[model samples]
Target: MRYDWTPLWRSTIGFDRLFDVLDEVQRTADETYPPYNIERVDENRFQISVALAGFSSYEVALTVEQNVLTLEGRKGEKDEKTFLHRGISTRSFKRQFTLADHVEVKGARFENGLLLIELQREIPEAMKPRRIAITGAGPGKVSQIEAKAA
Candidate 1:
């Protein structure tokens, strides 16, 4: 089914970039050359796995720009060889994931034809909200109320 995104624009402000990114994400998601999966490992950790059967870690490139995570792969050049039929795909592909603020990429490793990307969430202490304690009635309470009511 098709969705109209105009309503989002009319109801919200300062979301132009968000709409642009969402459009890009939808366009790229329709492609089916390479398949991937995103799994939440823990409360503060995540793992992104992509099926890279014929691709190697050297051919894969991982980059983080702004809040977007991008992965690109390029197969090495091969000498021309005569073949009756070719079934496996060797073309390069690119995938991207939009990351939230304060999310960090810990590292990436490849094994058994699977590319695994690890991510961690590091929240700043100052950004976290804290509760303020309410003190008991003080000596100035009576005078404070009388002066205000006056």
Candidate 2:
């Protein structure tokens, strides 16, 4: 299935990335392997936790390229063991996450069968909001009394 974004493109400017994100989301809608959570730690900090119950840190790989974060888990060969009711999954899985602009992966850690990825958005100083001082219309536009108050 495909989505037509012609109207959105015509009405908005500089939102190409938003459309791309939407497309990626639609393509991966059926993915359910390695359930995860996205939590906002603060205004600019975030954490992504993926449940990898039976996988060790060495069995999982995390990579970030361009603006996409990919997580892959490959289970190692297990010793022959017979289980009457096998439930835990040991299958390999791959997950991808599209990151926004200026969002960087701070770090990653595996704890308690969960893989946690930290993210932080660091806006450049030039891109940050600033107060612009407004001056009089012209050099001589200020009233005499107002100028004396300077």
Candidate 3:
């Protein structure tokens, strides 16, 4: 499916990235080089696991640019020995995930042929809900409406 964002694109400002992301997602919908999965560990935590069979940790590169997490895998020199029927793939692949505001990458680990990426969403202190201290006007302080009514 495709969407036309002509109206929104013309009037909005600073939303080109969002529109571009949507378009890119549609364009890359058929790209399934390296399988992956995303899971929400908690309200503020997330994990992404990518299946990279036959690829070591040194072959994969993880980077975060703005709110996008990019994972690029580059296999080193191939084995000299030939296989009768090779099945396992160790090809180069690049995958990206768009992160929400305040979300950041915590850490990552490679285990059992899976690259596990940890994410945490840390809202700033000012953005969090805070209780405001209400203060009294002062001693004997009254409104003009009270005097007018009397």
RMSD of each: 4.2, 6.3, 5.0
Please write out the lDDT profile of model 1 over residues 118-139, one tens digit for every residue. Answer: 9998889987899989888787
Give the runs in model 3 whose Cα sits over 4 Å from its true position.
6-21, 130-150
Residue pairs with clashing backbones, model 1: none
Q: Write the per-residue lDDT of candidate 3 for residues 1-150, one digit (tens) a residue.
A: 888988898899999879988888898899898999999999999999999999988899999998989999998997898799988878888988888889999999988989999999999998999999989688798856545545
Compared with the true structure, what per-residue lDDT tens digits does model 2 show for residues 65-129?
Answer: 99899999998988599889877888999999999989999999988988999999999999999
TM-score computed on alpha carbons, candidate 2: 0.84
Q: All models: lDDT?
A: 0.85, 0.91, 0.91
Off by over 4 Å in 1: 6-25, 79-85, 134-150
The Cα RMSD in angstroms, rounded to one decimal, for candidate 3 relative to the true structure is: 5.0
Return the candidate ranking by lDDT, descending: 2, 3, 1
Model 3 — TM-score against the truth?
Answer: 0.74
Per-prediction TM-score: 0.73, 0.84, 0.74
- Looking at candidate 3, the ten consecutive residues that score lowest on lDDT are 141-150
Compute the lDDT for candidate 3: 0.91
The order of the candidates by TM-score, greatest first, is 2, 3, 1
Clashes of 1: 0
